[model samples]
Target: MESIVMLSGNVKYTITLDPSVWIFDDRRQDLHTYFHEQQEEKDTLEEYTKEVSKHWDREIIEGAVVPPTLKTEKKYLKEELLTGTFCIPFKPFLTNAEVSENAKNLVIETVDGMVTIPLTVAEKMVLGFSKDGKPLREDGPIHCYYGDGSNYENPIKNVVSFKIE
Candidate 1:
């Protein structure tokens, strides 16, 4: 019953048949810390995604919501695109915002002719509100004069006020 074995070229070897089966003992201690950090990052990203989703949903809801059967043709529907009563495509503008380098200012004429303001991020609430300082209808379009933030040539300059009609 020899405890050591000798093999070719005078090499000696020792073998532990049971090999401690606890290889993951050290890693298990830090598992919880790793998981906690991952959860924190995940939660932060989820909050960011939710905020982005809110704006995305608003654009989608504001755009044309026509039923599937009401379409005259197979045109691609865009949440960021608006269709006027004349079937004209009108793009929106964020207040004092320039979406792209080529975006220009635009005008919005409401059907009621009650309110007209610049379409901007800061003015969203103003347009969203009713004349009596009450809440405006969320489903309908709030008319305004918008600068599309494009057209570098003129860029809708010298335009300060907008008309309701």
Candidate 2:
């Protein structure tokens, strides 16, 4: 006879946003159109729009921290070093809201509540690495930003963390 035991643990991640990370722009309308074109039901559309609108004018930042894809790492180091990549998708919003003309005094929110940092913090976070990092394949976090981008800057700060279930 044999006996086996299984145990599992859950972890919660708190992502902090830099103050400089302000919303640069919004594309809610586009998102709404996409859903409508997809033939989504009214309730579905309303729910999607409402949920996404809450974070309207927010920025969506996606990044991946992963190891090198090449096998050359084995020859050089005993352990593989992790690398990261960051990017701002063209369409990051999911509602229909007009763009903002003012970029000052913008609030940046994340999973860990609101925080402030540099405008270029996100870009600085993922610099010096390839943007081809695969979070899904590498078991990394996929961050989404929702805020105004009127005063958005290049290379948004990276102040978020991921928790996988």
Number of backbone collisions per candidate:
12, 33
lDDT string for model 2 (61-112, tens) is: 3223333643566654322112223323322120112213332122333334
Measured on C-alpha atoms, candidate 1 has an lDDT of 0.26
lDDT, candidates in the order shown:
0.26, 0.28
Model 1, TM vs. native: 0.18
Per-residue lDDT tens digits for candidate 1, residues 1-165, read 111111111112212111022121211112112223332213657878998997678669876555565463444332111221111112212322223334222233233332333324223221211112222233232212122322212212222223211
The TM-score of candidate 2 is 0.21
What is the Å distance of residue 90 in model 2 from its true position?
Answer: 7.8
Off by over 4 Å in 2: 1-84, 89-98, 117-132, 136-165
Q: Considering every candidate listed, which one attains the maximal TM-score?
A: 2
Candidate 1 clash figure, as a count:
12
